[model samples]
Target: MDPRPPDETPGPGQQPKPPFDRERFIFKTLAVVIGTQLLIYSLAAGVCGQRALVGRPVGQICPGTLEQLQGGFDSTLKLLLALLGGAALTRMAPPS
Candidate 1:
């Protein structure tokens, strides 16, 4: 004679939530932050390294074009890894 439908289970028992894991959470967050910083640094390295240095007082060239190319490739790899890391972290996060 109660109005509620039989299909609906009463409150708390129906859903069981996982306990918070602070260590795991902190570790994950730290990893994510490191990944983000790496990504930024990589991209910045590509840009900063690519600049043509015309006149250095020293006769020797500090960085040649090959170094710039290497920087670009390294940066691209770091950026790609960061994105992949973020995806993994997102999956690991708790629903709460």
Candidate 2:
């Protein structure tokens, strides 16, 4: 009889499975999503330029519309920061 727990015991010719790491999984997923978003945003900004995004001449003073667009971007950045901060905190917490 095997002395190991049933779940820990591997069948003949089978490798033991590693324990699932929730934290690593979450970090990797977030990295991929954030990386993709950055890539997309970089491409858009490069191709479209600030003038296209803001619908104004470059270096010209603008009001309302630029702020609205900038506010949206700022909100998105804040949300991403919050998500990353929460994930970091969760990782630092002691396991239950």
Leading candidate by TM-score: 2
User: Where does candidate 1 have its weakest 10-residue lDDT segment?
Assistant: 54-63
Off by over 4 Å in 1: 1-13, 53-96
- Candidate 2 structure quality by residue, lDDT tens digits, 17-77: 8889876786677677667666655655554476667776645333444555556666666
Q: Candidate 2 regions off by >4 Å?
A: 1-8, 11-14, 50-96
Clashing pairs in 2: none
RMSD over all Cα atoms, model 2: 6.8
Q: Report the C-alpha lDDT of model 1 over 8-94, residue by residue, as the tens digit.
A: 444865675577986577667767765765676566555545543433243224345446556755775686577678878988999
The C-alpha lDDT values of all candidates are 0.62, 0.67
**TM-score for predicted model 2 compared with the true structure:** 0.47
